[model samples]
Target: MPSPFTLAITGQSLIHHDIRACVDPGFLQIVEILKKADVAFTNFEGTILGRHGGSPMKGSYFGYSDPQVLDALKQAGFNALALANNHAFDLGPPGILSTLEEVRARGFLHAGIGLDRDHAIAPGVAAIRSRLIGLVAMDAGPGPRTMYADNARYRRPSRPGVNQLEVTRIFEADRAAFDMLATIQTTFQISKLERANYAQPDDPPVLDEDAEIDFYGTIFRRADVNRRVIAVDPDSASIHLEAIARARSREQFVIAYLHHHHWEPNWRDVPDWVRAFAHACIDAGANVFVSHGTPVLQPIEIYKRAPIFFGLGNFIFHTEKGETEWSSPDVWKSVVATCAFDPAGPLQIDLLPVALGGEERIEGLDFHERQVPMVASGKIAQQIIDDLAERSAIFGTTIERHGPTGRIQVSEGQR
Candidate 1:
C-alpha cells in the first residue's frame, strides 16, 4: 500500500452517444497517476446491467455503458464505485440485480443501494492496511419507487413492469390485485398498531381505524382493477443506519457516498430533510459524506468534525463533443468556491489519477482517444481550478491553486 493514500471523485457523466470513445487513454493516464496512491473511488453514473425488459419510466433519461466499463476501471485500478444514483435502477430490479452480479463477479465493492431500502444503507467497505475505507451511494429527486428484495411480486421470475411514475397516475388494470392486497396489509398493520398503542381508548387511534375500514370498503367499492400496494417511496433511513453499522464494525475511516445533495445553489433554500440527513449521518459516525447529483458542485463543510463534500463536478465528460460547453470557468465556480485549503501552506494534496475508460469518439465512432481536447489540453482544467480557488476565497476556503495546472495542494492549516 502507498504510504499516503489518495482518491479522486467527479460528477454525473454519460457516454450515451459513443460509449467506446467516451473513456479515453487519458483515462489510463489518470489511473496511472492514481495508481501511485493506495486506492481510488468514483461514481459509476451509468448502469451496466444486462436486463432489457424493465419499463423505462416516463420522462426518464437513461444512460448505460457496456459491462466492459468495469474491466476498464480494474485496468485503471479503481477499487470502489458508488452505485447509489438515479440511473442505477433505470431498468428496474433486473437492472439493479445485473449490476450487483457484475460488480460481485468482478470482485469490486459497491454500496448505497441494493434489492431494497435496507441494502441502500449498507456500504461497501475494503480494509486497506491499517486503515479501513467505506463507500455509500444515495440519490435524491423523483424516480421509480424502489421495491425491497422480499416484496412478493418483484420476486426473481415474475414482477410487474416498472416505469417512471407520472405526477398523476390514471387507473391501470394490472395494478388492481396488488393494490387490494396492499390495502389489506396496510389495514392490518394499522389495526395492529392501534391495538398496540390504544392510548386513551376514547380517541381510539384516529388515523388508522377509520382509514382501515374505509380502505377495505373502498377496495370492494372500486371498479378499477389496477390498484397495487407496491412500496413506492424510497425508504433509505434504515439503509443509512445499516451502512453506519458496517462502518463502525471496522476500525478505520468511515466515508459515505451519497448521490443526493442537501442543498443547491440555485435553490434559495435548503430542505430541512436534507440538512437532517447530513447531520444524522454524521451523528451516526460517518467521518466523511460525499454527495453528488447536482449539475454543479456545492459547498464542503465539516459539521461536528465530519466533513461533507456536497458535490464533485463532472470529470469524464471533458472529451465528449457537445459537452465542451461546460468547460467554462463560471460553470465550475461552485467547485472553486468550496475547496478548503490546508492551513499549513501550498503543498500538493495527495493527487490520485482516476481515469474514464472504455472507447468511443467525439463523432460517435469506436476508437481510443487519450485526451479530451478541452481538458487534456490543460487550459480549461487549469482555469476551472483557478476559478474555483478564486471563488472559494469568498467562502473562506483557503486552497492552493497551482499557477495553471488546476492541481490542488491542501494545507494542514497550521504549523
Candidate 2:
C-alpha cells in the first residue's frame, strides 16, 4: 500500500486580482492551513486572458483573470485546480486555450478544459509521495451549448473548451395545468413560430408522448404534481465515469469534480440530481467527489467511505463593486477541508471554517483586500460549523464540532 496522503480542498475561486503581497493575518492563516496539505485543490472558476487573445463571449459579469492571479493562488498554496466552470469559456475557445496555457505554465495539476472533447474528458494525473492522484473535472452547465468542447466532424475542426456534463431542466405539470399550457400554445401558435424561426433539421424530434410538450426550448412533462426536475445527460455521465474508472484502474486516487449553476430554489439545499450523480461517480471509482457553483455552502455526505462535498461555496470570490447578487453573508462563509487517507485505518477529515475578510466590512478596504478569506473565530466560527453540521446531518454524516473546527472520521467498514 502507498503511504498515507492528505488532501486540502476549497470551493470556487473567482479571482480577478493579484494578492501575493497581502499581509492580512486572517488571509495568511487560511493560507497556512492550505500549505500544510500534500495536495491543495480548488476550482479555478474563471478564464485566464493571456497571450492567446480572445473576445468576450459573455455579457454582464464576464470573468477573466490576469496570469498573475495564478501566482497569487500558487502563493496561497493551491497546487491542484479544477478548470471547468461556467465562466471558463467567457472568452470562447481561445480563452479556454489561454487559460490552459497559463495554468500549465504554473505547473499545477489541472483538469476539465482541454483542446478537444476527448482531451477534456481525460483525467489529469500528478505524482505525490510516490503515489498517483488523478482528477476528472467537468462542468454541468445550464450555460450555452457552444461553450463545451467538441470533436472534429465532417468539415468542422475540433473546438477547445470546457468539459461539459450536459444538464436539462424539466418542468412537470399536472393534467389541468398541462392542458392550460397546451391551450395557450395552440392559441398563440408558439410551436409554429419556433419551427419557423429556430427549428433545425437535426433537432431531436419533439417528444411524441401524449402528455409532454416542448414549449419554446423548455421541456414540460405531464405528471401528477407541479415541480422542476434536473436531468443529467447519461452519455456525458458515462464519459466522465469512464475517465474516473480508468484512473482507478491505474492505482491512482481519483477525485471527481463538478461545477454547476443548477441550484435549488433554496441555495442552501442540495439538489437531488446532483446527489445521485455524485453517488454514481463514487460507484464508478472515485475516492473523493466535490462540486461548486452555488455561492453558498451546501451539505457534505460521506458515501461508501468516500467524502462528497455537494457545494463548498466561494473561497476567493472577487466580484465587481456594487454587485448585489452575491451580497448575502452566507456567500462569504466556507470551510477549508483537509482529508487524510490512511490505507490501514479510517479516513479523517478536518473542516476549518473561514470568513471573508473577518466577517465584517472594513471601511477603507477595496474588493481585493476585503474578499480574501480569513480563518473564522468566535461566535461566527461556531455558527459556520453548526450550520454545516445541521445540513450535513441530512446525509447521516455527523460532523463533530470542536470549537471553531469540525471533524469527521469514517472507518474502513463504515459503509
lDDT of 1 by residue, 314-412 (tens): 544423333444433333222211122222333343212122222222223222232221223234444445544564455344445444344443344
lDDT of 2 by residue, 198-244 (tens): 53422533574687887766678999999999989898788899899
lDDT, residue 363, candidate 1? 28
Highest-TM-score candidate: 2
The alpha-carbon deviation from the true structure for residue 80 of candidate 1, after best TM-score superposition, in angstroms, is 0.7
Q: How many backbone clashes can be found in candidate 1?
A: 30
* Residue 228 in model 2: lDDT: 95
TM-score of each: 0.61, 0.95
The list of candidate 2 runs beyond 4 A from truth reads 192-206, 362-369
lDDT of 2: 0.88
In terms of lDDT, which candidate is strongest?
A: 2
